[model samples]
Target: MQPPAQVPPVPPPEEEPQELARFREEWKAELQRRRAATAATQASSSPPQPASSSESTLPASPPAKVFVPVSVSQPRAGPSKNVLPETHPALNGTERPTYVSPGLGNALSIYRQAVYAEQRSDLDEALLLYRQAFRLDPHVDRAYHREEMLASILQGQTAAVKKLTVSAATDEEVEQLASNLQNTLALSKPVSTGKAVVTGTLASLISGFPQELAFEPENELESVPIKMLPDELLVLVLKKLDPTSIERFARVNKKLRVLSLDSTIWRNLVSKTYRPPQIPDIEYMIPVIEKHLSDFRRVYIEQPRVRFDGVYIAICHYVRPGLSENSWVNISHLITYHRYLRFLPNGQVLSLLANEEHSPQQVIPLLKPSLRMKGFFLGNWHLEGTTLHLTNLIDASGRFVLQGLEPPSSAPIHSHLHHSSNTTSEDRARYVFVMSLNLRSRPLGRWNRLDMETYESISLETGDATPVALKHDRPFWFSKVRSYGLQV
Candidate 1:
């Protein structure tokens, strides 16, 4: 019976071989899938490698293990499973990696370039690039980047940090950047050379409180009221000022305006500054003075004619044609003569004349003798309206001769002398001048002095003899002199 049972030996179970074949096919399929996946990943992630000369002939080595996270129930040598949830959570079926669009990646690249340009101080290019990046990706991060740029500008940092990254930037990071920028700006500001000093008094004054007042009993000091000051006091203060200052004060208020415009103030000013030569009847000149009050201020204060003292010296130039250079044709030979006149307050006058050959010093000696004869002229002057009148002209030549001075020689003395005779009454009459006061009341104006011979001849021809109505010559301008003997 045993020999008959052993005859049918057990062939290996057919089911086991079938199961092994199925497992081998599944394993091969998994290996092929992994290889295809690895090749696709390499193609997408890496650039193509250049072929070497011996690469095609060389034998390939076994591929190194790439420790990628994967789940497998196969037995291994290690005790623990190779799980990498943090690195590749998708493999563990925990979490999938987030996908970023290509457009967003491009925008990020542009943002990085913009940051680099800004760091390089290329603001225009950086701004343009930033705008393009924002247009591509309108996200909160882009908005924050824009805000960061604005904060940089506000902090006075046109150049951004070189290593700044948009992905890592946060509100806290931006705030820190701004703080650092502010600190840098503060350091860059111009520092004062003066040392800083803090006093308790100054601190209290700035805070509007006394240092000890807080702890002391309440006792406030009374404040003085400036507006409550009397009008009389104000007027007194204004009266002490000059006309210009008074005018400025009048602009302060209506009350001061009325006070400054008071006629008495201007009248006082006129009397003090312009002592209009002691006239007999001052009442007659009052109306004239009142009418030209503004003119008086301009002539005296604004444009003062006289010096601090009361004297005026006039230098006159008489230009006329001389003997013709060419006898055949009439040609102008221009000649100029200078005449000096010194005026005093008591109606005294001194006269001198100069030529091209001599200065005033050289001419003074040649005319010294004449200085005794016609050296000085005496007259009484008065202002009628705005016209100056010189009357009672007396020849002091003979009177000085009686004082034991020899008579002047009749020979030509000065180069500009028109006569060779002793100083005559006709010559003396030329020193008397009747001047009209200009609106400026300056010493510059038209004047008519008697040319006795011409006046007599014209009177003899016209048969009028009405003091020979004299016409004023050219304008005679005079400068104010501090003293009578002063030379200009």
Candidate 2:
């Protein structure tokens, strides 16, 4: 039986190559299943690491490319996540990698809001939004912001431009913005070449609401053109503007500079806004008034100043003869003091002592000599043609003392004496000042004394007395001490 089974046992398992091949295939399938499970777990648990430079060449499909226009009018929902490392040759050799991230998307949204606000002339809100966008993502394109800034400047949003310039992170950025502005100005053309008639009532002439001359860019891709408004329109606009605004506009261009010098504009402005003190024969002084019209307007509306607002000095000589022989002698003395006279529009005046020395002292030695004490004089004044009439002089010298000096202990002697004296009301002293307009000299002009007065004096030699009047006409030279307002 063994011999008979030997034939079948001999082949017993002549190991089949097919069986070995099957086992190998089964092992490979199990290994692949384990690897796929591990890979799925890793992909769900963590984000994929960025490929190193060595792995850049690995066979992997690239992400879809996204092109964001430099100037986007509307906001996008979100940015992409797949960012490819690539250099943009067009963006000034910058690495304009796909900036698709949550932070960057929020930044773009904020930036879009800022652009809309700026377009509507809501500069404050626009600036705030722009700052917020940058804070969220500094990697946003600067050119977009630059374009918005240039647009604002072209629209004459000066306050906004100034604020943006101040907010710049570096001087280089400011310089770049300034350069862009200069380029825009260089390309600017006149707003309207046609001339329009300025016909209307004087009151209605400046009543038109200010029309904003904003620059309308042809498209989102083009630079905004600078606006050059017509001279007639400019004049009308300037008439409605305050002096400060007009002055600021004058610095924009040469055309504005010439337009700002229109005499009629200033004259009309002064006549409409200011009421000069009642002047007699004002028609005769038209030439003089026109010559100084600008200055007068500034003085009336901007700042009112008077001639008696500075220091003055005068020397006087007096002679007295004594009862004895060879007793006649002349005494000379110097008078120095500062007078601050502020003339208000309500016909009232404020006078103050601006000098360092309060007490008056004679420069020349004398005995029993009368001294004119220092005091402040107040009253009302009026303008008669080019002359100033100062009258109703009730001395209100009790206000202030000289700088660095204490106030007086008791009321001045003149206050009581003038009140008690039996002098007629007509005998009260009044001052008449005639102004000389010297256009070439500073301080505008000089105030000359048109009236003279006499004072009682006694000689120290023999106690003899006589009346001495100011002989030399000492016109008090003056300058503007400070500006005056209607209220003060």
Model number with the top lDDT: 2
TM-score of 1: 0.29
Estimate, for each residue in 336-410, the C-alpha lDDT of model 2 and write its tens digit. 433333444345443333222332121111100011122444335455444454433222332211121212334
lDDT of 1 at 313: 28
lDDT of 1 by residue, 94-155 (tens): 32222244676678678767666665566678789889988988762433343333232222
Instruction: Kindly give the stretch of ten consecutive residues in candidate 2 with the minimal lDDT sum.
Output: 66-75
Report every candidate's CA lDDT.
Answer: 0.36, 0.36
lDDT of 2 at 12: 64
Please list the Cα RMSD from the true structure of every candidate, rounded to 1 decimal place: 53.4, 43.0
Worst 10 residues of 1 by lDDT: 66-75
Deviating ranges (above 4 Å) for candidate 1? 1-269, 272-280, 285-332, 339-341, 347-376, 396-472, 483-488
- 164 Cα displacement, candidate 1 (Å): 95
How many residue pairs clash per model? Answer: 0, 1
